[model samples]
Target: MWKPVPLPYKSDSLPLPAIPTAAEIRACTNVLWDGAHRIVALNEDVVVKYDGGLDATEGQNLIYLERYAPKVPAPRLYAMFEEDGKTYLILQRIPGVPLDSIWKSLTVSEKNGITAKLIPVFDAMREAACPWPDFYGGLDGGRVHHWLFYSQKKKDFKFLGPYYGEDAFVAGMLQNFRVSTERCERPDFKARFYEKYLPQVLRGHRPTLTHSDFHQKNILVIENPCPDNQGERSFEVVLIDWEDAGWYPDFWEFFMASDRNVFSFCDEDWFWHMQQFLEVWPAELGVMRLFEKDMRGH
Candidate 1:
């Protein structure tokens, strides 16, 4: 919902350190993450993430956060450019561990402390004024990046977004749904039922900013001992992976966070804690689960 401004990239500006080759990144010893892409720590202060399949919007989303939602703690993007069919993002190397790494060992008080700190981070996103009334999509009118918006077949894929209102947003979803139906060998008959149910279920919602990939793994936290209070610790939380961050229906954050695949654990404790911060939309989530089932032809 933050007001987005144009990026300052110019053709004449030099991209620092000269974008590296895939071979160079593979050879780097300080590699931090290696999955869909490679995240290499160039030094103590700087790191770079590069991949041929990376979304062009990832760096742009970081820039959006830096400018509009300053309070939302995220990595600082130093440089971003594409070379040899790969996108590279130079970022500030944050000093902390991913929340999921320590979730199981933390005491009850520590968990509550972390959860309390996270509430304000989300509030900063939710409380920001919408850039345009009823607009839903990526920053600066880019395409929406939710998992539901992705397709395996690029030739027939439609990247729908920047919808003007809830109606348009729902229409866009249905359009993508219809495309998926074409590929299904045995389409669910409930697709027709959902075609009517979805609009009503998703209707009358206002646009809100969402980190669509909200999960413990993307959250970085550092612990500090409180000098004045005995045995007390303070936590600093920073959100990472902004590729999926954008404006969407208010319920999208809770819905996306609750996804079991990304939530890291099927633990009911984690689920209960999430409800404390994210606005719960039981009906919407239930309906969307059905929508997901039909879309994937499960």
Candidate 2:
């Protein structure tokens, strides 16, 4: 069902990463002509991937998103495949500008619309039980039911000392996971943020197709709305980047977005954004609320 649509091609000229040139992209891989992924400069579209991961499900995301097009500002996947120990995923190079560049210029209605659209798309993904949840990575799966603890591949959790500390919590969570993760975790943070807010995180939730890393960077904004034939503008949303895509706790996405990199990425605007979005989501808060509590000794 999921397949790549053939694109009309002209002379091969691809837009590459501003810093890392295509040569660098090619040089990084083992097999240039037959590598896992290499740079193919085909008219402003430069791809970075590796098909030779020995993972049969490699490049599965290209097929997943292609079949289910979310009505938002995401990338257009044009092609995907693996050959000679390398994988390739070709996508339509989105042309317009970065959302962050024009975020302030964007009307609040536009921002609200984007926030609203995510729910439906998330629902569609959950209903279908489609894996490859985000631009991160995918998991071999079928229809999922409840929250799946990462007991199987339990990686060490890092702590950022009341900031983005997944490691410390990772250690602690592995310890008294049986104990309630409520008040014992709070320190210097405010009340509603941790005590009351976080406890709700894992109370009522089941994991669906969580993007695991749906930050704004992973979410691209292409064209702004233009006056339609009837003077109305309908927004089109396209999701891109499925390397980090996978099945995991929704808090992972919320945590990464809240302020990743030891809180170097904090933004009050996004703080309010989460507050408002949480009112709508109502579920994701429980998981993230706990993380917020664990991050602060203040």
Candidate 3:
């Protein structure tokens, strides 16, 4: 198993862009999205995402996709930097509104049309195999990272294992859970949890490049203009937010997609459409959720 490493650079050693303050970011009238740790602002054709000490892996992931998985429709990364404990990623803004904003308003036929477009994209991602079978986290050739065990306050930015097989990867996930909780100090409890639940939930599965958070919000949809009195107006689906994307077990995508945090509002039709591309294991998700509750002592 791979051990966690401290962030290599000190505060002063980071090569970064001019740090933009909260006031400066807030002043931007073209704010695209605002969340807890990151704020995305647009300036004409460029989109700048300012991460307030959350995660910098997305920028690197974008670069990796551009080079390795060019067929995947993602934003073009311009530049990235780490400054004053914040990470800034400058990217070419893809033309589209988030699917979530317009999903509820779309007719059933329109919704099916979007789902049809996504089918090929999901197939391509599943077909994009990693060069090394052992590599299980983050971009294939970039600095390793894991979004599942991430915490802003702890600053536990160390990369997890590039495990050789499914078993090792499952073990790595368990280790990460231990590290994230106070259970790290209790070996007996850890041992029991591992022996009891791990076997039930962790099954042998093939690995694939998964956009772990593949919910509506992370997807962008754009309607193309019909020219020369053409046929139907086509829509393009662009996947965004590669922060949580990585190579993982085939089931990882389904498990993460099932997360309520990913889908804020319940859309039965949208849910049904996603299942067509991938299968969800409710048994596995249930075990995982139980483990999470135990870790948090809830």
Candidate 4:
């Protein structure tokens, strides 16, 4: 179960002491100047993260999910508080480790099997309701940020390419999708495919919630607990890090999820998969559609 960790909060209002030394903090690749994630110890409970955002609303979503919904395969949020410029998520650090560390060892059948298992969870989310107003909805709660859509007259929301590391290898993968799918008419459409995919082609299929960051790192393996966990592992696939989850079409997670090498299934397989995937993809997500719409004149 992806339940939040329980902590001794409230009575202890003051922020937890810093773990000391940038060396120590820097050692954990998960740490940020905006915050930090330390192991503490193998068995030691509670992951101490520091966040500067005053509201801590973003952090609260994890807390809420950790408490209310343990069955949906998300980490538990035990306690959180904001003081100074920092916020912390005292969560039950997920047991199994990052999926990528173990992805290479999985046989082809195992890989496809894992891919198959993830679908039902996606279906479960699709059948649910979107809590937020915009297309980007949160799984636990909705509307963590102020998101504006494109206006035909205005052409809004123009940030192109991956926003974070979890958005890793997206631009490159799309480039490959274009060349392999033979839709390389326009470069910009290749970039904004998802923006068009939603509300346009996918208006009908939009169901419940989606773990927008459904990649290797955010997902944890259950049966083969990363050799590190040794024993005591439950839940074969636990979804962690509900940062950008929301109500979205299944295609958002399906075709878009890729690796540095994460492309369509086979050589010509890209064409068929792209054709099938675009059934729901926004006009912007397809290079051909983009080339036709915004790049024809050029």
Candidate 5:
């Protein structure tokens, strides 16, 4: 069971740990990426991830992966601590560069080969059965960070949901969506969304372990020394950033793969190949798009 740590400050309070000082990030060179919630830096061979008093799923996910899917290549968690309401994770950095960095340089065949390598990893995830099939949430028994709640809630809001199943999860989503769009005064649109899309999404799909953010940027690749015919080089694939991983409905993988927000490299070939490698749920995606548009008030 995962224990919830009380945030040091109230919800109304401003963000904590305002931009780590030089002394705080000691020996950490070459800032990797600074996003709204966390700042990631490279400290020699280790990667340091700092979260600004919000979100505990990253560390928890790492721990879960280390125990459950040891073969799946992810950054090994070395150390973790909380200071001044902020969370810091020290991880063993994977050696290769992000796949997206070299995506444009690779030939079509090379790209396809990389996808082939990833199939086994996906298979492993699919094979790993959920300990509690009744719930739909994170590995730590927390709420899933779906786009629906993410857009409406505060950054620090601990969205820990363990909805019973797809029906419960969708109900929660609909409720939250209503709250988010209460000001719009559009009940009919909500009704239309519920009537048209909800049934299609419900399709009696079983839950499977899903790397909810399996995108090109999250995939690391290193070229194999030996090259096959056609001069296409084989590569070792390492999936990273497991913060959003959880046991989700069968269609969740397809929905997330097609999500452009995280998967920036959603090119025609990549999208097509991802569908070929895994299941594609176009109807679910259409519903998600409707929700997205509604949230954006479009």
Candidate 6:
């Protein structure tokens, strides 16, 4: 005798957290972070981040890293879902203080040891397989998330990309630059110079996965967690906040890490430490700074 079994119909809906859990989240008083998104500590082991509008790619990026680049220390994503115009992501709570908190007190040798460990971690990330070999974008093959593709003229504009090649990516960047220069009260002569030289300046870079925001706050460190034979404490680092992680030009990691906006404010020698781990593209960085100036009006 043959009997037919029926299973529930499947749809593309994401998993939803328990109703009580969601309710508690909305009313949770233990907020870890308050910014564009709200991060609430659910318990000792987990935290949930929710926002009215968040880039879904961030969760995907975490999954991608865990799957493809396991050596890169990052948070474990427990659950992610969308409900009622808001997105919620439950994640493992990594135990460590932010690097910036104790950076000033670290001895030069200790700093060097910490950075030495990080160099290989970044190397592993760069070495991870690209989801789309020919395209530069988010892990899901969606639009690139970097600011270069952001539309300056449009309010809350959706960035453009998943470019098929380096040339196309450069074209997208120049298009945004043009929009930014258009209808300005004063003539932006630098815009004209960038229009002419940008293609040449931006040429010959292969796409690499970049954690575009690599600052002290985003990096967590556990100091003296383990002691070796000499009774010296070993340093450990875990990187967080993958919101801006994506495929970008090879030089992007260096450029973003070297930006001075935070140099005077937090971790004064952050740039110097960044230089130790990243390959310095002096000429490209200089040109990128000029472009950053044009884009930021500095």
Residue lDDT tens for model 6, 1-298: 1111111111123233442256778898999888978888877877788884674567777777776789989987777666666667777787788988888887777788789889998888778767676578876567888787776675757888779898888878877777777745547677778878988878888888788888788889877666667555568899998988888888888888777433474636667777777777878888988888777772
Instruction: Report the alpha-carbon TM-score of model 4 versus the true structure.
Output: 0.53
Ranking by TM-score: 1, 6, 5, 3, 4, 2
Ten contiguous residues with the weakest lDDT in model 2: 156-165
Clashes of 5: 2
What lDDT would candidate 5 get against the real structure?
A: 0.69
Model 3, span 217-257: residue lDDT tens: 88999987762243444578999988878788777787777
Lowest lDDT 10-mer window, candidate 3? 1-10
Task: Report the alpha-carbon TM-score of model 6 versus the true structure.
Answer: 0.86
Q: After the best TM-score superposition of candidate 6, give how far the Cα of residue 45 lies from its true spot, in angstroms.
A: 0.9
Q: Write the per-residue lDDT of candidate 5 for residues 1-298, one digit (tens) a residue.
A: 4443342312222123233343566545567767744445554456667754445577777767777777677776655666766677666666788887897788888988898888888888878767775678887777786656553444545564678777777777676666666545566677556646676666687778888887788899978989986677889988887877887888888777777533444544677667656787777777776676766672
Q: Cα lDDT for residue 129, model 1?
A: 67
lDDT of 2 by residue, 156-226 (tens): 23211111223323333323332223325533334434444444344333334455545555556555458
By TM-score, the best candidate is 1
Q: What count of clashes does model 4 give? A: 21
Clashes of each: 0, 47, 0, 21, 2, 0
lDDT of each: 0.77, 0.42, 0.67, 0.44, 0.69, 0.75
Error of 4 at 253 (Å): 3.0
Model 1 — which ten-residue stretch has the worst lDDT? 5-14
- Provide the TM-score for each candidate, comma-separated: 0.87, 0.50, 0.76, 0.53, 0.82, 0.86
Candidate 6 at residue 114, lDDT? 85
lDDT of 4 at 295: 28
lDDT of 1 at 22: 50
Q: After superposition, how far is residue 91 of candidate 4 from its true place, in Å?
A: 0.9
